[model samples]
Target: MAVLGLLAGCSGGVEGSPVAAERWDPCSITPEQIAATGLDPEYRDEGWGKGIEIPDWGRCVFHAPGGTAYPYGLDVTSSEKFTIADARGRDGNLSVRELQVGGRDAHMYKTETGKSVRDCSIALEVSTGVVVFTVVYHTVDGVDSCQVVLRHVNDLESAIPAGPK
Candidate 1:
């Protein structure tokens, strides 16, 4: 098995307002790199939060600074069927849906109460079988979800595959 690298958090996309970039220094590794390490980076989003009370389903992954915080941390697994939207804290009100992202299968779940603005997207890397899913949610005068999602995706892409760029 591959040595599991350090884990980190990423942001999704937002609808209305703009968002800023984020920078962090960790033992960065992509889904593909994880496989190279002899570990198959499975699941939908490795960094999924659990039992967090999110107002909207999309916002679950897309978190803002000082906004409604998620108590759970990232959950990683080797299951191909991963969930991007889950309302573990509240009732089963939250649900997830699947889609084709980056030429691969992906999922996007949201609550009915979520406005159209509350949407999520994902990209998958077939080479390393890495999935980059982003969820956009509304915040109370906070950063946009889109920004976070974009940054997370970018970071993962950069860290994976030590090959010709």
Candidate 2:
């Protein structure tokens, strides 16, 4: 979780754009969504919005009970910057892909550590902003990181309604 500790200040390559109040609360994700990722929704840190300003994005982390593994948890946040193009860039980068899930355009990236795959993220643009879901787990031997991320994306798409931007 050391990586998680230092990510609070990262831009994630996104430039902040004021999130319209009517479109997004900017710091809310249902406990059900957290539970959907197999983490204990009850033990959550709602401090994602802490020290975070508009457009850049606040992040939240959820973990399983008594879990000390590298990624037996999930990391989530939203950015006003569009990752659509960067996600679709095929110039030598082989891990990015464009996707259509729940009748919406999405981009997914598979991030790996050495020969072992670490995590994967799926991002979708809503009327409010870009919604990003990341799935993290230690090993992909029995668990598929990309599939896990896609499942979370599907769950989120059905739960969140696009708001006025």
Candidate 3:
């Protein structure tokens, strides 16, 4: 995937790729807002950054730029009702396909760069006016692209306002 290219470039170990360091800033994210949720958070300064917010439509979403290595994402909502969609992705020299996992009706998709190790998953759980989404991804080496996203979905979900009656 393009992310692999970016990731490869980040480590500066790959030949013929221009190596560069990556940095990220949160867009549309508020520390005060995140603090209000009361869920302990683990923040990491991965390259390309992340953003968390309650969109104008009243759904909470977290997004990351695909410009960096292992670019993937998740979006969740509780505006009309509790719902979630978690996604992981790579966007280079690879094919795109969708798969359904475990018959729970939740879906997962992968966008890769080449015929190499790329992986991702997304899930939702809701109860007691709370919605939780779990998203995960790893390379063939089992190294994560973004561990923060996996550890913080529950905290992010708790920040969403209750769904309608």
Candidate 4:
């Protein structure tokens, strides 16, 4: 009986309830919009890939042209559970700057610490929760990742719903 009690205590199970479904689907982005970002519209990958699923989050990744020396990827995600404040509080988020995207509250940040080129992300506040645009380059090509993500966000701003009034 003591052994059974110890086993029960050792069981680490998930706590609390699952989050609600995402209010906005990032996969709903149109092909034209993807093309406008200089990525291949047909190479869209939905979800986290490899059959992984994250509750209350919708994601889509658009890949750049193939047969290139420096290929980049653009990932767009919408979350009903995470807010801008949550993103700001996350660790490893460097140089976080508040900005406005199409009149909506937004933030741009870098993932790495040093000056070397690295991944960049921009989170825009939406009515549902938050929508994030991230740019990851496979190789260094002197391209500004932040500017790339900012341009993509600007191009897709019309598709994203406005935040609270």
Tens-place lDDT per residue, model 3, 72-130, is: 33433322233333222233312223333222233333345344534333333233222
Q: Cα RMSD to native, each candidate?
A: 19.2, 14.8, 20.7, 9.9
Top lDDT: which candidate number? 4
Tens-digit per-residue lDDT, 1-165, candidate 2: 878778866747768886553333323667776677566777655445567555466466666555555355556666545444544563443378788888777888865445654677776766655666777676556887788778767766766546324
Model 3 vs. true fold: TM: 0.28
lDDT of 4: 0.84
Question: Candidate 1: deviation at residue 11, Å?
Answer: 51
State which candidate, 2 or 4, has the greater lDDT.
4
**Candidate structures ordered by TM-score, highest first:** 4, 2, 1, 3
lDDT of each: 0.35, 0.63, 0.36, 0.84
Per-residue lDDT tens digits of candidate 1, residues 1-165?
A: 133332223334456865432222122444554344332344223133576432211211222233235311121222122222221222432444445432344443333435534433343333322333444554434554444444454444445222212
For model 1, the superposed segments whose C-alpha errors exceed 4 Å read 1-64, 67-113, 128-130, 140-144, 160-165
Best by TM-score: 4
Q: After superposition, how far is residue 143 of candidate 2 from its true place, in Å?
A: 1.7
lDDT of 2 at 21: 37
State which candidate, 2 or 3, has the greater lDDT: 2
